[model samples]
Target: MISTYRAVVLTRNGGLDALELRELPLEAPGPGQVRLRVRATGVGFTDIIMRRGYHPDAPKLPFTPGYEVVGDVEAIGPGVTGFTPGQRVAALTVHGGYAESIIRDAGEFIPVPEGLDDAEVTALILNYVTAYQMIHRVARLRAGQSALVTGAGGGVGTALLQLLRVAGVQAYGVDSPPKAGLVRELGATFIDSRERPFDEAVRKRLPEGVDVAFDGIGGDSIARCTRAVRRGGRLISYGFTSAVGRHGGGDNVGGLSGLLALFVGTRLLGRRPSVYGITQLYQKDPSLLREDLSQLFTLLAERRIQPLIAHRLPLLAGRAGQELLERGGIRGKIILLRDVPKKT
Candidate 1:
């Protein structure tokens, strides 16, 4: 008899209902692939877009939507080394992560650092690594600098805020009113985005201008990031949770118009400021994606960065996570399937 494992497969796209938890044959890792017994999976905004069939870069239909996973290696394919069976690990596979078992190249998996729980480490992988790479590698933030983060209390936003605070830089986080405390807890000043304009909100925190702006809101939110920065400051536009499948990419919602606006604004201005969509690390060095994962795992060992728990849901109830993230009530990461492993 074939062994079966549960997986949330996106055979097609539309709503959270598209994610069907069903049985699949559990197979051994192919060459250089590591087979993981998934312990926890993070529900990110990207997954939200992919589930909606929007994100232009999202995988073709009938593919899994999960971007990252935290789990233990149960098997390895030929030529795979540096990891053994039963070793705790986390990976940024970009797909196939929403399953009880997943296979990916060995280079993509990072061993979970000592003293960290699988749930916490899984929560930290993609969002924290993406934020860390942009802030440290791309922005090269300096001490005493100021920064603005849109969606400030979300996974990426919280990570950015925390990193800036640790570097001795002031951070302004734009989030909903209920998340205000969580944003402030990350050592950032919080602004309730629903009630105030982002520029005015951030200005109240930094009367001058901010030095760097990390924007994920991707609609007119880019304009807010624009207004917050001082002359010569850099703006990193990455996510478009609001514009997910729309704008510069294709049909959907918020679109990349926010990004286009930044580019246009740069051209209209005298050219002192630089506005570029992020994906910089991915463009420059894809290997850095894995390296960033490694670095965060190291930080986790030392408690330099911590995971914020918003809510935990079952892998089958991904819609709950999607709703929490979409509603914007949660400040930290939402982890799915706390105790259940997809594979036995």
Candidate 2:
């Protein structure tokens, strides 16, 4: 068996330089665990926050930063059943996925159907599932209802538009001028928040407001989203990009406290305030993630949804992939494919 593998470790909280590509020792899978030969992992803004040492959920420095990965089973520990070597699987690792191999609890992974692209599958594990659960489970939006999606053209934002279109929901997507075309292409009415504030743009188009609004760009963006929501409509705050600064250099505590204050203030206005964190929800019930992800896999199989991949970089380019995501202007997800060798 292989003894060591390459991984991108966050040596210290800082800029892109903090991520170091190094060879790390590998260990045998412990009981109830499986070692995965990672095929692809996703690079997201959450990883950016974690890298900057601002994310409250981040582990100590000098750890991996990947949140989700798709891989083939390399080995299985004793007491783990129903999994054989070479089986492709996906997991919500939340860390340790920016490596060539990872040993995780068997229960953390679900069997991935054959024929699906590994990079696309990695996108679904976090982006699509979050979109799916927020729309169906949290917002519980039904067909024909109108909703607003902020940060449209982002990983989760694009996922929301695609899934909303599939569900027959009318979507108004708020984004920058660059992403307007992509958002509209996904069957959403595009609102360029950069041209005008998203709340004003949404309200101008939807005088009565929308049935629901999904805002991932937190901070004052939360309150802006609530304004676009109808009296009885709900606003779901899923992320805090602004709070943490898209490229870092933001205050974590201030951002979170401000988020809570907005929730309370929005509630006082008689608007239903809600929040959705895929990790937190998954922790409450792992089966929900399994079920939702299974459905997403089927959706991909049927070609009902497509994960827009902005860039496919080699595993060692994890830091570069994240830099692209942070710089923005990309329409969709950035994937780190382990099978692709980094250019020398």
| Best prediction by lDDT | 2
* RMSD of candidates 1 onward, in order: 3.7, 2.0
Distance from true position, residue 164, model 2, in Å? 0.7
Judge candidate 1 at residue 13 and give its lDDT.
Answer: 70
Tens-digit per-residue lDDT, 1-344, candidate 2: 66899999999989999899999998899999999999999999989989887776788778998999999999899899999899999999888888999999999999999889988999999999999999999999899899999889899999999999999999999888888889989999999886877878878887989999898877777878878888878988888788777664987676876577467867876789887899999889999999999999999999999999988898778889888887778888999997764568
Clashes of each: 6, 0
Off by over 4 Å in 2: 252-261, 341-344
181-253 in candidate 1: lDDT tens per residue? 8888889888788997988877776776788888876778877777777767777877666665322234343
- Per-candidate TM-score against the hidden true structure: 0.89, 0.96
Q: Estimate every model's Cα lDDT from 0 to 1.
A: 0.75, 0.89
Worst 10 residues of 1 by lDDT: 270-279
